[model samples]
Target: MLKILKYLKKSSISVVAIVLLLMVQALCDISLPDYTSKIVNIGIQQGGIENAVPEVIKEDDLKKLMIFIDANKQSQVKDYYHLIKYKDTESDSYKKNIDKYPALKNENLYVLKDIDKDELKDLNELLSKSEMALLTIENNKNQDNKIKESILKSFPIELSVKMKDKSLIEIMEYLPKEKTNAIKKEIMKKIEKMPDSIIEQSAIIYVNKEYKSIGIDMDRLQNKSILKSGTQMIAIAILSMFVTIIVTFLAAKVAAKLGKTLRTDVYEKVMSFSNEEMKKYSTASLITRSTNDIQQIQVMMVMILRFIFYAPMMAVMGIFKVVNTNVSMTWIIGVAVLFIVFLLSILFTFVMPKFKLVQKLVDRLNLVSREIITGIMPIRAFSNQEYEEKRFEEANRNLTKVNIFVNRIMSFMMPSMILVMNLIGILIVYKGTYSIDSGTMQVGDMMAFIQYTMQIIMSFLVIAMMSVMIPRASVSASRICEIIETNPTIKDSLDIKTFNPDKKGVVEFKNVSFKYPDAEEEVLSDISFIANPGETTAFIGSTGSGKSTLVNLIPRFFDATKGQILVDGTDIRDVKQFELREKIGYVPQKGILFTGTIASNLRYGNRNATDDEIKEAADIAQASEFINSKPEGVEFKIAQGGTNVSGGQKQRLSIARAIAKNPEIYIFDDSFSALDLKTDAALRKELKRKTSESTVLIVAQRISTILHAEQIIVLDEGKIIGKGTHEELLKTCEIYKQIALSQLSKEELGNE
Candidate 1:
C-alpha cells in the first residue's frame, strides 16, 4: 500500500482538499443530532418559552416580594406594588383591570379579607347567588418556574415584623405559635382554592403586558431557531453532495491517469527486454500484468480516495461528539467498533494470501485461452479438441471456486454489521429509557445518542469494506511493480561508442557460443564466420542446429554468451542496441505483423520511406503480385499477427517490410520456409540483385534455397561440420553431400 502511495504524490493537493471537505461534511452530520435534541427538549415539551411572571398574589405577599424585586430593580416589582396599593373601594376597578394585570388579584383578596365582617357576609351571599363572573388569564411560558415567588410573597408580614423586633429564637414566642400556625393554614387553603378561570385571566394579563413591554414575540424566536437549524442542515447536505460528486470525478481521473502511466511504463520496459528477460515473464503473463493487474490497482485507488480518508475522519469526529455528550453510553460505541474491527481482521487474515493466487490463476487462464485460439487448426487436425476443452475447463473451475469462496465470506459482512448496529441501538434504548424516567435525559437527547452511535459504527464499517478490496488491490500493485522494477539483463553500457568501419554490412562471429537460459548445454559452440559486404552467406542444418540463434545474435536480440559478435568490424556490444539494430533488417522464423494497413507495417522500420520505395521493396520481395490483386492493394488492412493472410503471403509481406528499411545488413531466419519453390526462387532472385552491395545472411532447410550462395555452412548438433560453396562442399564435405543429394539428383549437383 505504501509503495502504491508514491504514485499518488502528484495528487497530494487534491487529496488534501478531499480530506478537508470530508471533515466539513462530518461536522455537518454531527450537528444534526444537536438540532434534533433541541427540537425535542425545547420545542415539543416546553412550548418554546422559558420564563413567565405570576398573574395573582395577596397584598401582604406582594409587598414582601417587592422588597427583593426592588433590590434587583425588576420591572415587575411595579406591577406587584400596584396590586398592593389598590384595594377595598378600588377592588372593583382592580377586578376590571385584572384582565390587563391580573397580578393585582392578591390586593383584591386582602380587600375581601379586611372587609367589615357584616359586609363580607353580604358579599359571600352575593357570590353564592352567582351574580359575579370569574376573571380568566393564561401563561405561555414553556419552562416550569423553579423559584416559587408567589409562595414567598404570600408569607405573613407579621413574621417579618416579629423577626425585626426580636431574635429568631424569640420570634415564635413574641408572635404566639398557635395564632401564626392557624393564620398560615387558613390563608394557604384559600389560595389553593382559587378558581381556574380567575387564575387563567390573571396569567393571560401578566404574559401580554410582559411581552408588550419587552417588544418580543416568544413564538417567533422558537420558529426562527427551528428554521435556522433546518436550513443549516439542508445547506450542508447540498454542499456534501456537491463535494462527493467532485471528489468522485477527481478520484476516477487520478486512477485512470495512474493506470495510463503504469501501462506505458510497463510497455516501455517490455520493449527494451532481451530474449532472457522476455523468458522471465511469458507473453500471456505480461498481458495480464499490464491490463487486469493494473485495473485492480486503479479500482483500489478510487476506494482509497473515496472512503479510506473519509471513514477515519468521520470516525474521529464522531468519537469527539460522543465524548462531549457527557454520558457513560460512549463505552458502548467503543465496544461495538472494536468488535467490528476484530471481525474484519479475522476475515482479511484468511483472505489476503489467496488474492495473490487469484492473479496467477488469471495468468494461467489467459495462457490457456490464447494457446487454444492460436492453435485451433492444429488441435482439430490432431483430434485433440476434447483434451484442450477439458484442460480449459479445469483452469476455469479453479478460478471460479476461489472467487466464490471469497465472495461468500464477504457476503457475511453487511448482515453482521446490521446486527451489531441493531444490538447497540437496543442497549442504548434500554439505558436511555431509564434515564428519561429518572429525569436525567430527555427523548431528544436519546435520539441524538442513537444517531451518533450509528455514525461511529458506520465509520468502522467503511474501513471493514475497504479491507476486502485493499488486499486484492495490493496483490495487483505488487504484480505491476514487478514488471516496472525488472532490470533488463541486456542494456547498452553508459560509455557506449558508435561503430564505424570502412566497409558496411560486414557481420562476423568470432568463436561465438550460445545457450538458452537454464539449458544444460550450449545450442551453438565455437562458431567462427564472416559475411563480407556485397556477399550472401547461407546456413543449412537439421532442426535445432542453432541456424536461427546464430543470426538472432547479429541484431543483439540476445548477446553471445562466450564470445563477441561484430557488426561493421566493431563489437556490437559496444554500440547501443537501438543503434546496432537500425543498421540491420531482421525477418523472424514466424512472420509477425501488427494491426494496420500493409503500407503502415512496411513503414514501421523506416517511417520516412516514400511510396516508390514501398512499391520497389514489395516488387523485390514478390509481394507486389498478391498486393496488387486486392482492390485496396498496399492500403489493405492486415489483422494482428497477419492472421488474415496465408503463411506464404505473410512471409512475402514480412520480407517486404524488411526490404523497406534498406539496411546495410539483411537477415532471413528460415523466412523462405513458408514459400513454394516457384515463389521462393523468384523472391531470392530479385533480392540477390537488389541487395548486391549489402551483406545477406540466410537460414534455410531446402538445398535449392541456398544453391547459388557465395558460401554455404553445414551445421549439425550445435557445431559446423562443413563450410564452402555448394560445388566444393559436395566434393569435400560429407554432411553437405548428404543434404544436397537428398534434395537434388547427382546430375543436378554435377550441373551446379
Candidate 2:
C-alpha cells in the first residue's frame, strides 16, 4: 500500500477525481434512507405536512428524486463529471455508438426528443451520417444499404406485430371481456372504503402529492420525532456516502498505484543486476513476482479501501446510535457485536493459514499452465497430453476445493451476523413495546435504535469479509517486496568511462574464463583470442563447447568471471553497457520476434533506418525472397515470436534485423541453423562481401561452415585446446583432426 501511495502521488490528479466522484455517490445513497424516514414520520403522520421542496419540483418530483438517488447509487455514475470534464473516458469511436444503427432512427423507435436538446440533435446527426448499417452486412450484402435496412427492420417488426414479453394473454384468456369492467368497479369500491388517514398517508408517501393537492388537513407535522429522525438519517446517509466514496476511490487507486510502483521497482532492480546475477533467478519467477504478487496487493488494497473501511465506521456510528437512542437496551447491541467479533476472529485464524497455502498453489498452477502451453507441441509428440491434462485437473480440483472450504467458512459471518442481529431485534422490540406502553419510550425512537443496532453488526460483517482476503494480500505484498529488493549481480559500474564509437571494431579476450553462478565447473577456461577489423573469426565445436558463450561475452550479455575483454584496445569493464552494445549487432540461434509488421521489427535495430536500407539488409540476409513473396511485402505482419513464418524465414528475418543496424561488430550465434544449405552458403557469401569492414564472429557446429575462417578455435568443454586455420588445425590439433576425419577421408582432407 505504501508503494502504491507513491504512485498515487504521481497520478494524484486522477486519484482526486475518483475520490470526488465516490463522495458524491455516497452522499446520494445516504440521503435515500433519510428521505424514506421523512415521508413516513413527518408528512404522513401529521394532519398538515410542513416540509417543502423547491417550488419548481413537479407532481412526480419524489419519483424523480428516487431515480436520481438510484443513479447516484452507482459510484461510476457519479464519476461522469470526470469523464465529461477531462474527455478522457471512452474514445469518440466507442462513445458515438448510435452512429452504427441508422435504421433505429428510421422506425421512430429512437426518438429525437430528450431533456438535453443538444444531445438529441447530435445523436440524430451522428446516426444519419455513419454508414454503419451497410458496413455490417457480411462486407458484401451489407454494402447494399437497401437490403441491410430491410433485414434489420424485419426483426423489430416481427416483435412489434405481437405483444412480446409484455403479454397480458393469460388474463385475457381467463376473464370474460364484459365481466372485466364489473370486477374492476367492485375493486374500486373496496379501495374507497379504506381509512381516510391511510389514503392521505399513502398519497404523500408514494404519489408525491402535497396536502393542498389532495385537499387534506395536514396534522402529520406535529409528530416531529419521526420527522427529525428521518431527516437525520438523510443527513447521516449523505455524510456516510460522501466519506465512503472518497475513501474507496482513494483505496482502489492505492492498489493500482502500489502495483505499478512495486512492479516498476522490481523491473528496475532486476535490470540493475549484472548479467552474472540475472542468471541466478528464472525469468518466469521474476514475471510472476511483478505481475501476480503486485496484482494480489492491488486487489487487497481495493477491498480494504471499499469494504474494510466501512466496517469500523459503521461499528462506531451504530454503537453510538444504538446505545444513545435507547439507554436501557444498550447491552444487546454491544454483546451481539462482541459475539460477532469473537466468531470472526476464530474463523479468520483458521482460514488465514489456508489462504496462504492457496496462493502458493495458485502460483504453481499458473507456472505449470504456462509451461504446458509453451511446450504444447512437445507434449503432443511425446504422448504426454493425458499426463499433463490429469496433472492440471488435479491441481485445479485441489485449488477449487480449498477456495470452496475457505468461502464456506467466510460465508458463515454474514448470515450469522444477520441472524444474531435479528434475535437481538426480537428482544429489543419485546422490551421497547413495554417501555412505549409504560410511557417511557416512543415508537419512532425504538425504531431508530433498532436501525443503528443493525448497522453495528453490518460493520463487523464487512470487516469479517475483508479479513479473509487480508492474509493472502499480505503474503503477496511480501513476495513483491522481495523481488523489488533483489540487486542484480551484473550492472553498469558507476563512473565508468563509456566506449568511443569512432574506433575500429577490434575485440580481444585476454586469458578470459567464466563459470556459471554456484556451479562446480568452469564453462570457459584460459581462453585468449583477438579479432581485428576486416576479418572473420569463427569458433567450431560440438554442443556444450561454450561456442555461443564465447560470442555472448563480446556484447557483455554475460561477462567473463575471471578475465578482461578489450574493445578497440580499451577494457570493456571501463565502458558503459549502452555505448558497448550500440556498436555490436547480434543474431541469436533462436529467432525471437514480436507481434508487429516486418517493417517495425526491422527498424528495432536502427529506429531511423530507411525503407531502402531495410530492403538492402533483407537482400543481404537472403530474406528478400520470402519478404517480397508476402502480399504486403515489407509491411507483412509477423505474429509474436514469428510463429506465422517458417523456421528458415524467421532466421533470415532475424539476420536482416541485425544487418539493418550496420553496427561495428556482428555476432552470429549459430544463427543459420534453420537455413537450407543453399540459402546458408548464399547468406554467408553475401555477409562476407558486404561486411568486410566490420569484425565478424560466428559460432558453428558444422566443420564445412567455418572452413573459410581466417582463424578457427576448436574448443572442448570450456578450454580452447586448439587455434589455427583449417589446414593448420588439421595437421596439428588432435580434436580438430578427429572432427575433420569424421567428415572426410585422408585424401579428401588432403585435397581440400
lDDT (10s digit) by residue, model 1, range 1-752 = 66777887777787788777767767777778887776765555433432223223354433333322223343423422333344544656555655544444333322222345565444333222111111110121211121122322344776554344342223323444565455334433443465433333333334344444433454675676567667776887787788788888888888888888889989999998998988889999999999999999888888888889888887888788777664667889978988898889888887777788889999999999999999999999999999999999998999998888877778887888899999999999998888676555668778988888898899889988887888788888888888888898788978887777684788888999999888889999999988987889999988888899889888888888898888887898898888888998889999999999999999988999999999999999899988999999999999978888999889888999999999999999999999999999999999999899999999999998999999898889889889989888988899889888889899987886
TM-score attained by model 1 = 0.80
Q: Where in model 1 is the C-alpha error above 4 Å?
A: 46-219
Model 1 alpha-carbon miss at residue 413, Å: 1.0
| Clashes (N, CA, C under 3 Å) per candidate | 7, 22
- Which candidate comes out best when scored by lDDT? 1
Best by TM-score: 1
Tens-place lDDT digits, model 2, residues 356-415: 787677766776787888889899999999999998998888889898988988788667
Residue-level lDDT for 526 in candidate 1: 95
Location of the lowest summed lDDT over 10 successive residues in candidate 1: 129-138
What stretches of model 2 exceed 4 Å from their correct place? 1-6, 11-220, 223-257, 262-284, 500-503, 747-751
Clashing pairs in 1: 57-106, 61-153, 136-200, 136-201, 137-200, 137-201, 138-204
Worst 10 residues of 2 by lDDT: 128-137
